[model samples]
Target chain A: MSDDVAKFLDADIPDPTDFPADAPGLRQLDEALRCTMCRELFEAPVTVNCPHGHCFCSMCIRTALATKDECPLCRHAIREVHLRRNTAVEDAVRAWGLARTFVLQVLREKEEAKAATVASKYFSGKPKSKKRRRTPELSSDDEVVEVGERNVSHSLKGHTSSSSSGVVPCPICNKSVPMQNINNHIDQGCPSPKDADLDVLLSPSSKSKGKQKQEWSKLFQGGGAGSATTGSKKGKGKSRGADQDADPLPKIAYDTVTQKRLREILEELDLPTTGDRATMSARHSRWVNMFNANLDASPSQRKSVKQLMLELRRWEEAEEKKKTRAKLDAKDFDSGQYQKDNKTTFARLVEAAKPKAPKKSQSPHEGPPASSLSPSDGDSIAPPRRTEVVTIED
Target chain B: MFEAGPVSEADFFTWEALIMGPKDTPFEGGVFAARLTFPADYPLSPFKMKFDPPLFHPNVYADGTVCISILHTPGDDPTMYEAASERWSPVQSVEKVLLSVISMLAEPNLESGANIDCCKLYRDNKAEYERIVREGIKAQLGL
Candidate 1:
């Protein structure tokens, strides 16, 4: 195999085997996070309304449903309309994605620590007595580990020594500001205040805390208002949240529609209209499926229209390449080899055709009738000169 | 019971495979060769599998093509006896199909036999069927 193909095949997929045998929960966690259809981490996961509430990546289920209406897991009847955004599972996946590397790091560290203890015990002569005496010290060692954990967290949060010191660094513009004023400084897009020292002395922390509370309450009030409106307008239009005003696209009955109408649909979606009728229908149908599935995702996780178009273009290009490759393969076909391979089938067909003469006049004898009609049938079968011309054209 | 991969690195749609005949059956200890032809939109459509130098079994056609419910899609039911649940779905993979084929070799579903001659021979003269199958295996192995 070529190095590139070998490397492509060697790409790592996170599986239960990545964890040590002792940690069973981590393995299950990894498995649970994967979509059953694609066997990859769920992307925009959505839950079906079945009794089991099976969750799958929105795109995966949508594609599967496009083929068959039943659920891939339990084989229960399901519809695209019953799919709901599974925000809880989505949040869990997001949190797991962030913590996976750190969890792996900690597990490796613990393994190394255990190995170091084992080596120390092996090297020392009085292992039992030393272990007994060091029990009390181990408690203090845990305290030191706790402190080490805090340091690691501080470093991860980019705070470093800022927790002990009053000055906090502005994350965006990278300037030191008072701890109390950091939020306001960030709220103002990290602009240098005209009188920073004066402002810190004048504005007490209490006022800033009250302002943060007001912002939180305002956010809740907005959410409540949005929910009330959505509740009232639920059946009229299934639009949810502020940004998701685009309703899910209904499936098109491609058979009933004319090619012109299909082109109009493509044009309506701002998609390219250059392909043939079949290609256009395939492109539009796939786009509708993707667009409808995108509506099932939480608004934050939804892909933009441009990204969907790009995906559609990529799919169309792949399909085009496959079609051309199929044509080339047909051109490369060795008819002689094919006939040789299927010789029995050809012989059987010839045998069936030959028996037609026997059917016309049979004294319950096959050979005599065939022999009697051979001259006329021979003349009738002598049209190969036309087939020779067709072969040249091919 | 079987291992399969692309016939060549450049073409993933065509695969070459080797299946060891299931134990405790007439076909036992015989290694069979097969080819799998996958559609461009696979997992949505089922692949085609045919044993090379066709096995002498009721479920295999004279031309070596396999006749199994799982390899047929839900819509393309020529036999009309297979249930929708037993037919191909996107969830069914090549591994599942191979495993099903192994069981099929052990216990052929004679109700929907692809080779009538084999099915009749199997039902009427059991010893003759086994002798034919064993001889075919020996000939395949050049033993």
Candidate 2:
């Protein structure tokens, strides 16, 4: 979990090698990386079994499944258990998180160097033609140096000077300043840190962030390699014979086991056992998946058994609510009650559906045009349109 | 998104899109053009998808407006034919809607069809339905 926290903490550092977070290009990239639910860079990204290829963070999907068992983007049926961690997307986001600042810094420095060369050319006593030819070489040399610095930074743990000269590149501004004056340059010359950045990085809430990360990582390591493969293989099993790798949890045969034994098992796992036999079996199955899945997560994302139990309860409640809602919906559409409530509306719709004046050319099989389709039948039991131009605003 | 963009830069609310008829369907080889009109409170509510020149499909109206469960508003459905899960929510984007429309074209929902004639034709006479839809596609392309 320290690794996860370290990654975030590193993001707080204003590195000269990175792009400004607010740059237009970075903003566009941010949009692509953001989860639709949280509107933040994806954390534990999971792709649903929807045809639209929609992705949501694990926490977001859990929250969403609490209310609806469908894809948010396409309204296709989906299950939290069926969600596959989008490792490719997760890797991309992780890579971007580390590389954004370095890439941006290189681009900024390159542009600045080009501007400096142009200014020097104008001010110097050199001929325009000679300066033009030399400027291209300088710019190309600058790019090579930038690339070299990037390669060095990736390989090295700490910053390294490009030259052994007394001057060293300031990590904050990427400016070559005397090694002794580097601290002075950062304190006096560099621009003040943005207020938003300070608020996020220096906030009091982040004080205990390290502790939480430690706890999460501890839980993650407990589950071991089987859990890791289960997390990765869960969603990739679209074809037959992949079910064996889908669930890491050992399936308990609730039917064969006595109720007392099942209750004991739930107690040993520290899961709730208040439900009936059927409910208990379902609850236990969900808990096993949740527990093993948490093990598959990175240290920062692993959930405690208590949290998993709560999630299981929420899922059960949502399922119960859906069943009741379906029952109510069926009851609401009772033919007798519907006709009694909308008799007048139905009469008008039927009347409107009839041909206004019989035309010999019109065939019975040819349905009425959209304009003639009764407004009542469009979406709801709304009143029929009396005129052609009765456009209802959404 | 779906090889679709706004018809004009100024009016982003309305978009002109071209959906390549999905493979393995009667609509294959046809490039169907349509218009998407998004509401101001989009994502919260679904946008309206209408074919430029009417499409002959069970789920599509004669005036080109498409009627599918995905386009319906979230929450309690007035028609009760669609489950709440099947309806639109704030998370739905224009890209998802277009993809759903394309899939709908390939596999029309005859149960709650917007076009009764097309629905009957599709159920009782699939050959005729395919022919009519193909002809409509050809007419749209002036072929």
Top candidate by lDDT:
1
Candidate 1 Cα misplacement greater than 4 A, ranges: A1-7, A20-22, A49-51, A104-243, A328-394
Per residue, candidate 2 scores C-alpha lDDT tens digits across A1-394 of: 2443344335443322135555657656756776775554676788888888799776556556655787876778887767887777866765665466556655566555556555655576365545456567676466556655565455343333433347855553344677666556554533323335433433335432444233333332333432454454333222223322444456587889899999877655544456578877877776665654554444333433334443454465544544554565454658887789999999999899787656665533332233322222111111111110011110
Query: Looking at model 1, what is the TM-score of chain A?
Result: 0.54
Candidate 1 lDDT for residue B51: 89
Colliding residue pairs in candidate 2: A17-A101, A17-A102, A17-A105, A18-A101, A18-A102, A18-A105, A19-A104, A217-A299
DockQ by candidate, in order: 0.23, 0.12
* C-alpha positional error of residue B106 in candidate 2 after TM-score superposition, expressed in Å: 1.1
- The alpha-carbon lDDT assigned to residue A248 of candidate 1 equals 74
Model 1 chain A is weakest, by summed lDDT over 10 consecutive residues, at A377-386
Q: Candidate 1, after superposition: displacement of residue B13 in Å?
A: 2.5
* lDDT at A324, model 2: 53
True contacts kept of each: 0.15, 0.12
Q: Please provide, for model 1 over B21-83, each residue's C-alpha lDDT reduced to its tens digit, 9 standing for 90 to 100.
A: 778898887777788887656666788999876788999999899999999877787767888
